[model samples]
Target: YAASKGAAQGLAAGIQAGKGVAIKSLEKLGVKYFWTGMSSEILKMNHYKEVANLTDVIYTAKLKVCDELTYDNFVNMCEQFDIKIGVYTEEVKNALLPKYAVPNALNRIVSEAETTAKEVFEAESTRIAAEITEQQTAVINATYSSWQIAITASVIAIVVIVLIMVIIYLILRYRRKKKMKKKLQYIKLLEE
Candidate 1:
């Protein structure tokens, strides 16, 4: 009975090791399959096509898992060896679906990019227009100020010229009256 129990324990350990290897292999295969499918789908999209095509050669060279065994292959192998493995359910599907669903994610990203670009363009255009208007206003104000200064200078010049002319006329009148007074005194002296 002790020998039989030891054999059962050994068999159980062997089965566990086999399951571990199978699970590891399946995980690698699943990752490769997911990436390959994603790459193919991305290459079909307009925006991602160029980038995906650039990396397509690299992906094909690196992701060489086409001959790897899948779950079905593992099951078939188990059948050939006459081993039975039971299936179990987990709550990972819902979590993984939302995380790996690329279509909706890509659509949201593109929509956000387009909206952001439009807003940036509008803001830049408005900024440029405002700058131009401000510059034009400055130029108009400068011209008006220059015209006012010129008009003021011209009025000042005219006033100065008139004052100079009036002073010269008064000086000439005073000199002529003094000369006439001297001539009249001389004439009176001659008559006396």
Candidate 2:
């Protein structure tokens, strides 16, 4: 930790020195500007793919629902749309389920339990949806937390194993030294 801190401090100092030199050079050149590494692609693409997929689910749910949608709405949406919300849900369902003489759109509507936009979401279904959402959130959070705890436990276990090995090595070394001492003493006594 100390070494890491020292390295960070050294880097900070180097950056500060570079900044001062850069400022002087810019002043001499009669220029003053800086460009940042943040681009639209970086902001849009990086660290957002997971959130992006989630957003698509949420957006689709929004279009299907006139009222507020719950987490269960998203879950139901996944089940209703494309058999599993695939990139080719419409195409696949159109080829398969639509062949049943029942349109895929009608099946989705029936599955969604809505006769019309006025009957969009049920109160009971909403309550159940909220509960399901809460449970799903808990599960995802628990999974991530469990993994972190497991990693921590693994690190502790490794440290303890190393400590045990070092302790065993020290004990063996001490015993060997005592045995050598006793052997030397017996040889000296015989010589005497």
Candidate 3:
């Protein structure tokens, strides 16, 4: 009987440890899955096709088993410990039943995870949106600046061309007037 009890204890301990590990694993997977989903949404919104595709792989593999795993672990541990302690009272059953307690604990864990994920997603989304907007604004400003420079240079070139034409016209008009004066003098001298 003592050996049997020792074996039972060992088995219970192993089961508890295994369940604990599973619960932790499930919790991590659930959180990571939630975060990946949020990040994927953001990536899609930002048009990051390649990166979003990569995240999709993780999304497919990540499992959301937090509730089921936690519930099972809670019930099994409660039963095992109650058995070990030889507590089979109606009061314990009524108070610490799986149906009553698992839901509450599960709800708390789910709620906490959701709240934290939402806060993180909101903050990250806002930051990324602002960054993209800033980058777009910078690109637009650069394009506008280049256009302005080109227009200014074109206007300057046009003005310089117009001034050169005006200068050439003035030089041609002055030479023609001097040539006419010489012709008039020669005619007056010949007439005299």
Model 2 misplaced regions, further than 4 Å: 1-138
Of the pair 1 and 3, which is ahead by lDDT?
3
Clashes of each: 0, 0, 0
Q: How much RMSD separates candidate 2 from the native structure? A: 27.2
lDDT of 2 by residue, 78-97 (tens): 33544432323444444443
- lDDT comparing candidate 2 with the true structure: 0.44
Put the candidates in lDDT order, highest first.
Answer: 3, 1, 2
Residues 1-192, model 3: lDDT tens digits: 334444444444433333333234334434233343544333233222122133233323322333334567655544443332233333555444433333344344344444444454455555555666677789999999999999999999999999999999999999999999999999999999
**Can you give the TM-score per candidate against the true fold?**
0.42, 0.29, 0.48
Model number with the top lDDT: 3
- Clash count for candidate 1 is 0
Best by TM-score: 3
* lDDT of residue 118 for candidate 3: 47
